[model samples]
Target: MDIEFLKTSILEFVQNHKSYAPFVLGLMTFAESLAFVSLLLPTMTILIAVGFVLAAADIPFWQAWAGAVCGAFLGNWLSYEIGQRYKKTAYELWPLSRNPKLIARGEAFFQRFGPWAVFLGRFFGPIRAVIALIAGIFLMPQVLFQAANLASASVWAFIILAPGAGLAHYVLW
Candidate 1:
């Protein structure tokens, strides 16, 4: 389906079924953050529309925000684990394997920014997963990566979700 259609459908579901909103939010976040998958999923628009649905449907903002944060964190953690376990092999297999520049750019970004790339890359869709993978490949200290990951994920969750939430709140109120 097209972006407009998907956005409309997600908003409709969010408004009609309040109980499933959290799950939907989580799924979207996971797809948006997961390595490889993130490159394909056009979830950003749908997720923002979901925020508007939350306001229209009276779903609490915290619930949606929490779901997004949790899913994003887990998705990146899994990607990091993949990087740690497979090393360069992971990048050599499908998706990243097909796109060598993804790893190259991520490495360059990480080299220049160090741990800060973890936090900053969260905001850039094209490089988010790559940065996470690079961080793992470089054997960045776990504590540092986690700290940056958590912080970046929170900011990312809000940056992606808040505008719709705010618009919905104002329009609905």
Candidate 2:
């Protein structure tokens, strides 16, 4: 039940299973970025912590970082596709349906920022999860959506992992 305990357990798991760090980190980032799933998982904090664990465990930072980037890009891509396919009905899906305000905010943000919303949203916690959905709903071009998604996801992964990695390196060295 304790969040810290869960984080510690995950860190321990990653530490013990260094070979799986990239895959696990990828999954974590995927869940963290995915629409609806992002709301429930709240894995960002744990992910940063895993960065520290990965460094301390000497699990190859580049591998973990790359995995995170790939997972994040794929997650957002799926969300965008879902939005495109489902349109407004995506909001009718359980958790999203329950929180209409999130959909509204995502829509407003997409309207206000346009394609840039996808790039900027990656940095913002609340809007990050839904912006892709909004982009899908509004039918943003695939090329534009992917450009921002890839760039932002890479940067976001670095931002999340670097600090912890740096701290671990500093302490370990």
Candidate 3:
């Protein structure tokens, strides 16, 4: 019921299960970036908190960062695949069907920026949810989509994780 409590619990768990830092952080970012899942779970805040937890737990930053990267890449890739498979009806999906503005914004962003939307969208919440899906629906080149996906995933993971990782040293220590 209490979101803060849930977040704190997760951070605590990550601190205690130092070995699972990568897995937990990976899963959190995966859910944070996934299409439908992203709409449901706001894991970004928890994810940032996790960075501090991992730092405090003494888990290697690269290991946890790699996990976050892989998770984000796979999550967006799955969404892109879904869009490719159901390009005609991606909008007909439940939550998306219920939310028209989200689609419109994604469409406009995709149209304006084209392939770069895939990369730029990662930093924006609304666009991030549907930009990759739109890219697939419009049949953007696979290589380009993947290139942006991987790069953005890597950068986005770093941006989200780095703050906590860096700040933990000064604040926690």
Candidate 4:
């Protein structure tokens, strides 16, 4: 039940069941992109670990990337919908609840860059999910929001997941 033990167990479980790798990757990416969940999930850490497993296990690099990309896209899109539907009310929610300053910063960031904020925000650790929500709250046009979201998610996914996977593959095999 200890955190380290739990993490080790999860990693062992996933490594044993190679077929589940994509699902694990997707879940990690989803948690990474989800609003309040991002604060809790150590996604960046787990993703590197997953990348190593993918390489060690011979999972195709592209497959893991695809899972990560889809999960991130879906997660951010859901956050955007929440922002659009709840507007400022989302600020009162659990994760964002305590981080009023973050929302404000995201708002200012969006104001400065407009829709491009959605794309650029994808690279910032704390800002990604928050920017998506702020875009919704600000009523950024849906088409533009999604365009940037999709494009950013692809590059972000590649940048985060590929290095470890590629390095492991090259070094090990």
Q: What local distance difference test score does each model get?
A: 0.82, 0.88, 0.87, 0.84
**Superposed Cα deviation of residue 156, candidate 1 (Å):** 0.8
What digit string (tens of lDDT, one per residue) describes model 2 on residues 1-173?
99878767866776788888788788988888899899887888888876778887778889999999989999999999999999999888988889888888888888999999999998888788899988998999999999999999999999999989989878656
Each prediction's total of clashing residue pairs, residues at least 3 apart in sequence or on different chains, is: 0, 0, 0, 0
Q: Estimate each model's TM-score.
A: 0.88, 0.90, 0.90, 0.87
* Clashing pairs for predicted structure model 1, backbone only: none
Clashing pairs for model 4 are: none
Question: In candidate 1, where is summed lDDT lowest over 10 consecutive residues?
Answer: 6-15
Off by over 4 Å in 4: 1-16, 170-173
Error of 4 at 88 (Å): 0.2
lDDT of 4 by residue, 23-112 (tens): 777888888987778877758877876777677777788888888988888889998999999999889888788888888888899999
Model 3 residue 56 CA deviation in Å: 0.8
Query: How large is the C-alpha RMSD of every model relative to the true structure?
Result: 3.4, 3.3, 3.4, 3.7
Residue pair clashes in candidate 2: none
Question: Per-residue alpha-carbon lDDT of model 1 for 1-173, expressed as tens digits?
Answer: 69878757766776788887777788888888888888878687888776777877778888888888988888787778777877877787678878888888888999999999989988887798688788888888889988998898888888888898889767756
